[model samples]
Target: MGVAAAQVVDPGSFKVHHVMFTELRKLVDRIIQIFPKIEAARPRCSSGIKALCSLNSAIDKAKLLLQYCSESSKLYLAITTDAIVSRCHKSKSLLEQGLCQIQSMVPVMLAVEISQIVDDLRAAKFIPDEFDEEAGKVVRELLQRGASASDSMEYAEIKALQTAASRLHITSLTAILIEKRSIKRLLEKVSDSDQQKKKILRYLLYLLRKYANQIIEEQTDDTTDRNEGAFGSNDPNTNFMHAHAFNVESGLENKGYDSHSDKLSIATLPEEFRCPISSRLMYDPVIIASGQTFERIWIQKWLDDGNDTCPKTGMKLAHLSLTQNATMKDMISKWCKKYGITIQDPSMQPDVPHLLETSSISIASFGSYINDLRLPLDISNISLGSLDASYTSDGSRNKNGDGLNLAPEQNSDDLRRDHSSGNASKLDLESLSSLAELDWESQYKMVEDMKNHLESDDLACFSMSSENFIEPLIKFLSTAHDLHDIRALKAGFQLLSTFLNQYRSGIRCLNEDTYSLLSLFLDSEVTKEILDIMEVLSCHRSCRSKIAASGAIISLLNILHSNIIDSRERAIKILRNLSLSTDVCSDLVCLECIPKFVPFLQDTTLARHCIVVLRNLCCNEEARASIAQTPGCIGSVAILLEIGSHEDQEHALDILLSLCSQCVEYCQLVMDESDIFAALFDVSVNGSEKGKASALELLRLLRVTNHDDRQQECFESSNVAPEDANNHAKEKKSHKALFGVKFPIFSKKKK
Candidate 1:
């Protein structure tokens, strides 16, 4: 058996026991060679059937090995599986075969299996005297290499054999039988010989008889069950109706070949003759020049109704709605190359069955269909409250907080209805003509009256600036905007913004109405101007007071974050200023601003600005500590190291060092996360002497903690335990300067 296995690897041999497996591998290589020559070959031969068959066979073999290894413990199982897999991968065109081999090895990885053994040992408290120490060492190495079971083993085949031997108590010879069974089963499926078919039938019959009765008994239930559907079962034909129906051999009976044809003679070709493209009845097919290319006229007719292309390869047919057959042909060539499948003609294979299915358009196209069926226009009516702030802005208030001029004002609807004849709020240009009867100049004066009254900066103006009083303000803010009106528009929004911020959380203020006013300034005309205002407000001591106010500087910053029309540099600059602000930075942190900042690190244009801000924040002990605790800050630190400028790296090191000083163990915590250590390697190596000194110091601090725990023992020491000396060496390496400070030995030590 071993000699036969050895012969399978030779490309020239076909008489080996593994002949089927060897042929499949060679077939894949030949298919790969023919793939590029497809365009020049004869039609109906372009479908890369051979390559696909080989790939499928290799995958089946790998799956078999995995199954056999799971069920049996034997060294021969490992050896045989490895030998067959290695044979499958000896050619460049066998990528699919190699992938299958790699995938099979994953289940047998020594690192993974050993790790599992260790876990089982710990769980069951099983420790054979000889295996205990070696098992512990294996576990430690596995952890250090990231717990990948396969990675720790030098050879996956060896690992598989060893694990099966240790855990399942089976000899290597028995393992070989399981592997042989798997290989035989695969060959049974691929072979077309009558003898092979009989053998397979006998094997399957044995398996079914052995398991059928037990399976049936387990499925029997005592509990009553409801009917799942209208699958009435008494009539014999009821099942016959559900059984797959086949049409008579298409196009042949019409040709007077009725001698062997029954009244409705049906032809069932072997499974291999079924069209891989459209598995149904084949039709008018003409062979094209290619390895596996075939052109079928009326190809679209095979794809059920309303379909135009092949569902599997997206290939357009000779008679379809395709705009360009040549373009589609090119696309099909690329698709075949990607999947390594040959193109087959539906018409030429008259004996083959081509199955019909619905067209496989992308799901996104269904949404387009729904949208196309929607109404062309929609109308909705909304009622908004009156906008007036005169009570607080223009009205007189005394020391007792009593209103001096409190009078009811006319509602906008009443003015529009009594004088203009309808709701001017709902009016478009056509409806504006109905307002001709009203004193237009006087109505404009009333708007002026409302606008002036809402601009007051005092808290007494809260009532007039309430959300109900801001309707007119919203209308004015929503005016026809252009660069010409930008300054005027910015001034209006700024006033509305100021009024809302002062009174937003107050009893009379309407918070929702404030955002409506803020949205108007989102126009590109004045985006820059609004960001400038945000920058100024961020600098204000009073900015903190307005943090709870509706849509202040933070709102502006959010708008900036979302606006991509302008370079993100503008947004980053504004955020940098806000991040630097004593009043805003703390509030920003409280808002958990790391998510907003992290993406900016990825933006090449805004990255420098973001890094500067991060550096500055880290420079402050409190801010750096707070940022370190952010959800993604540890990952963000690694990113910053990869892309940050030299100065930024130095500053980050300083912050980390300061954090270490304040919390001596903090350094160890960050170092424990491998990603953080990886990040530091980029930044800590090239800094100035002072900066490098601090990094080394932080490293030393972490080492001392390791020393105290006796976790490592790889350093030189004569009297002290190796583990203790390892701790000392780590700490010493961390502080080169400190290590150089030598201690004197007394002359009495010579005794």
Candidate 2:
């Protein structure tokens, strides 16, 4: 214990990059001080053991980040300034949060020490210091030059990067090769959805190889210049580096299919088919807010890192939902087939028909994972709030609280009611009508001013209750926009968005044109702005029919299929809001939106919205019947019960129960899916307080259904069996019609 505590390095003891992890370093000192008290007590409760292990995991993350910053190339570190600072802040947050969780769990004598640790955490602040600015400037110049330049200007550009590399102390071919590979890895991990960035990365990789070749190709007659076995005549890493330079020279130069090349070669895997996070061919490609597609696991990791931004474009995400990119996945599968290549999907494999099996985990680094529940010696014997159906690296999780959002303001739209008075708020309707007459440049400036007033002046927000308020906003936002119209449209939409967000009553003032105009802009530059206004407006009871009639739902269904995540979420939010109406629910069902929404059940950000929409729609018998008929919908909801939040899990159970209660055909649909059965069984035995009640209730409902079906089958069979005694096949099926579920869960006592 003493030795383990000693491993906590103080800020003063750091040998290099002292300013980088200053906050984390201060927290480490506090941990070291408290370690002695914890070591002596060694509290054995389940909570205590779990908290310690969680704290240990956080510490491991911090240590690895600190070590990587110290050993990695300074230029690489400098170029990724935001990412590095984000890591520091993330580690500090975890340490602070983990320490607070541990305070209550630790023994009484050590509780005060834990409190002191929290105090140290509160005082430390992590602010980004000025990094290696010269190195970053060199990278920027190189990328700009590479974007538009020829051999005539190549020598100057190449010389500039080389000089910067030398200044940052990167001199050897081995070092250059390492940095080049780092860039390649980053490129593969970042999606090509942002085309300009993809092009810039390819060019940078080409330039580094070009510089390395200079050292390899040069020969000297004197001391001025010499290149003889520059990478050493025999080293393996260097030799591999030399070969890599050749292979990448043309491989990344043009990202297109080479029909003349061997299709069967493993080297022929197209870059676009590979997942940004996994660097492997994606079986399940999902698009996020930046319009980039990534493997579901890695992108979820990006969100948990606490910045709700796209991995490729660095754009702020509207939400963390991942929409399935079916086109890309299909293309990937076809490409694999054409090349005679094989891929594995863990979910597709044949497995034991149980929920608590080993089919749940997938980690790149280790074969097994041991969480805090497993660490506690008495945990299994205690049997508390835990289940065998665990979520792994690819499973559902909450957004780390550091992001700007918390849960979508619960029932935010329900707070709005229509107002009749525009004159009471003193609106300038005449000035608002003149927006369409202004030129684009002048219009954008005017829109910016409006947004600033709305942002800074509380009275402007208060004026949103006026019936005429939406008229001016719509006049600014509703004009038919083009590519050239992006700035004014974006600014105008932003102003409208600000109005809707700041004052809840603005939604009450929206008109037919407001809902109808959104459909036209679905394919425009201001799609984000359009969706934002519609998401809030669709929540109003009176607006649902108009929003559906405008053909916006169909466009939203299409947006759900596209690779842009930002637009995808706003689109779904609108759909979810529209689903509140029974007529709109029927419309969504006819449009085939359930299958689209079901694919995102495992997504953390969008799961609640999906389930709530489904649950609300299930209240309508026609919609419930349609959901039961939809393939994979019930099964996906079952997965949600296992992976969703406590409240959502209960809602999932309610959806299944609602469908099953409708008829025996619906009950049979519930029984047909093995995952659904297993999920229910798991929840009944080991789910949350609310979830367990819902699961048991659903199971009881299913049992009553199976019993009625069995009685009917037996009555008919009694008359037919005397003549045809060999008809046990029908009887055998009826015997097992309960879907492998025994009725002991809620067994009735015999009188």
Candidate 3:
């Protein structure tokens, strides 16, 4: 037997059930001692073989039960103490009965041994351990309040959670995540037919989520404190809304409800999987006229009750019609099969009328086990028709019968890359690795000294053969927020820019947290250096949002408008990069940046840069309208067609197309500028292939929207060559008309 294997579980790990397990061990050991004598006697009668088989089955069951108790979650064991005690008594009872039956058939010596074992089993009384007695009292209190919709965060409930967490040794995030996964596995083990078991599992899951949420809130607050100090924000209104969005990313170590089991948790199940009326897993599912699904018997009963509202959405039914949802039936069948869940017949009454209120664990033990939720279970309260209108599941008996085949927990620490290897020289590797292990003060001292030597080193003309070596080292910049030394901060920002400039494509582990170090706190000492780094990060299309939120948008705007600045060019480039995200563009528009950006369009060197930024801003509806309304914004963009690069000319044409299409007035605005018509003619005939396509498209948009008479007037007003005008008119004649259709700004909407 695996009796020794069960005993291998750490004793402290199962503090609540220690006493029960100890008695179980004693009983199992006594039976093991008698097994040898029974085997040696080898009684040949049918009765002897039958009695021996019964004893063997009981022993195997006991071993498995012990193993389950040892390996299961401590909190699970603590709450299910009643079921644990009852099962122990039953295991002992069956063993005693088997021994009594075998006594008559066994040989004289073995029969004497069996009678003593039966006597010992009868003398045993299975009860919860001392710790379980306290746990039971807390559980009873929780159950009394379980009918409420809240998390029961009153002093008593919180104290109970805290006490239980301490007992289970689940103090770390990693432990909570592991315990959550364990409970989730147990939830998957439940059969659909076992509603009582499902409730207990659901309640446990709810409690664990509350605990996890509390931990998340605390950690988030700590990080927000550090971030606020680094950014120098004192506004009480400055809430960390981004951190609260952790439900999608930071929620529980990226387990993220990303697992199949999480997706199928009953709380978040596909609505169709549950019958709206009973708020239980649906069987014999049927779709009503409102397209909501329900169990056939419930829908039939609802119809028979003279009610006609869709139970889920509460809309009046188009008609009282029900169609069998074969698709739902098939899906339910596949889900049950995949998870090994058993669906019970909804029509059949459960064998135990009050399944949760077991004989061994009566609700009356808790004075007034009130289940009153003021639930309007019928037509009067449609809101109560929700699944959650019922009380939470708790303390009902769960069995470990078919048993669990739990995989050993995995350690992911080994999966991370070892920096000590790869193509870098050992000296370089040690130097890089040492920086990561240093305190912030020492790291600042080292990075400052290393940056100066790099610029003058013999290796300046050459690059590392492994090109990606800098990516792993980029994580060193994550500590930049903690350093207060100005020169060291400046040196770190310079290296960050250099790494990104040289290894942007190769970099895979860019720390967005490093971007937070870009606050105006260090503006006087390292604004130029940090702005340079932001310029590089912004060049990556995916990194723009983090850059925009890094507390430097104000610094960048100030640099843009400054009378004297050494970093204005880099500031403009960063803004251009951020313009790619429509959200950033809308922020710029709200800041009244179009008027500021309009002047940059006339500076030939900055014209291409300004026009390109405006072009990206044009992607957002508000920004597009703002640019159209800004005086000279359109003309400046049109100037890019003549003075800009081929790429810039294409962007210029795109901006005009956007302005023209947004409203009839902007279309006429483009028409009023015959210089733009001439630029369009020039681009249509001689610009790059894409530029020519855009130029023609903008011309077509102008022609389609202004109608032929208005377009001819704008063309007649232009001072274009006769031949170019004829060429433009001929091109327009051959193009297909798109009169009322609005283009989905380059095939997708941004922002």
lDDT of 2: 0.58
In model 3, residue pairs whose N, Cα or C atoms come closer than 3 Å (at least 3 residues apart or on different chains), thus clashing, are 199-393
Worst 10 residues of 2 by lDDT: 370-379
Model 1: worst 10 consecutive residues (lDDT sum): 378-387
Model 2 segments more than 4 A misplaced: 1-440, 463-473, 476-484, 602-604, 675-678, 688-690, 721-751
lDDT to native, each model = 0.38, 0.58, 0.58
Model 1 segments beyond 4 Å from truth? 1-487, 490-525, 536-553, 560-568, 615-626, 629-632, 662-665, 673-685, 688-690, 709-751
lDDT of 1 by residue, 279-345 (tens): 3222222222221222343333333335555544666645533232354366555544554544434
Per-residue CA lDDT of candidate 2, range 1-751, in tens?
Answer: 1113444444433322345454465466567557546544546878877666556555545554654454344555555555666666666666666666665554433554565465445444454433244555666555444333457556765666665554343455555655654554444434445444444445555455445544332211211121134544344333334533543344323322233233435457789987765565676889997899987655665575566877678799998889999999899888877777666551232221222122121111111211110110111122111111211112223222222121221123311210111221222223244555688566666667667655643224432333444675566564535435667778877888877765554566666676677787877777887787787678667778888888888888898887898878877788888988988988888876777887777788888888988998897777787688777788888778767877788878879878877777887777666566567878888888878888888777777876676566568668675656346535545325445335354333358
Per-candidate TM equals 0.26, 0.40, 0.35
Q: Candidate 3 lDDT (Cα, whole model)?
A: 0.58
Worst 10 residues of 3 by lDDT: 364-373
Which candidate, 1 or 2, would have the higher lDDT against the true structure? 2
Evaluate model 3: give its TM-score. 0.35
